[model samples]
Target: MGQGADHLTSNQAQVLDHLRAANAPMTAYQLLGRMQNDRGAVAPPTVYRALKALEEAGLIRRIETLRAWAPVATVRPGVVVICDDCGTVRGVEAPGLLESLHERLVAEGFAEARKTIEVHGRCGDCAEDRA
Candidate 1:
């Protein structure tokens, strides 16, 4: 939820703000540049620290496939779709069916499904370009 922004550490808030504005996943180095351009110089470790904190808080998520990060618009269960050709990333909220599946998994002895799924493919733009 957007209200959770109030609970983040200063650096985490800054990173989340930047990624929310970005509207797409970004690598740590790219975020570093954005931070420097917007504020004064910042170290990579500082950004990584903020990122780890934000990830743990569910305020943001990492696209492990791309090694990039993006802000989580909502805390609800969802999936990350990535454009394999252009590296574009989009987060989609899972429908009720997926929720039901997760519930079934939990019933079958799985832990609460907090992990978001990641799917990679050529996005519409890239597909159209190929055509």
Candidate 2:
């Protein structure tokens, strides 16, 4: 908490740490449990506040379908891909992926739409295990 600590408040730092270390997305309630020791009296409001701060800083993102949060994979605008089998939420990365998607949407007459895509399915690990 000493080095580069001024970038975040203690609560925000604690919340980000938990999300960064998580293998899967976590709800705010779950984050409270993980941060209670550091936060000393973590509650729903406290966690929510921290989450908002982290989101504002672009350090994390909330998966609307899962109602959980995960650390942002990159600074670029991208889509969220949620693994249904393992509940892992990750950012999708592909060259010009967003642009292609936008082009398709525009062709479909949804040019004015604001896109927020979340593709749900088994991830590579689970898919391989099943095969």
Deviation from native of the Cα of residue 63 in model 2, angstroms: 0.6
Estimate TM-scores for all models. Answer: 0.76, 0.78
Tens digit per residue, CA lDDT, model 2, 1-131? 12223488888888888887888888999998887766477678988998898887777878878888887752134678788988777776765977787788889988554556788988899999889
Candidate 2: misplaced stretches above 4 Å? 1-6, 37-39, 74-76, 100-114
lDDT for predicted candidate 1 compared with the true structure = 0.78
Query: Global CA lDDT of candidate 2, please?
Result: 0.77
Q: Give the top-scoring candidate (TM-score).
A: 2
Report backbone clashes per prediction: 0, 0
The true-versus-predicted C-alpha distance at residue 95 of model 1, in Å, is: 2.4
Weakest 10 consecutive residues of candidate 2 by summed lDDT: 1-10
lDDT of 1 by residue, 1-131 (tens): 46454577778878888887784688999999988998898999989999988878768778777788877773234778877787667777778868797889989899873665888888889989989
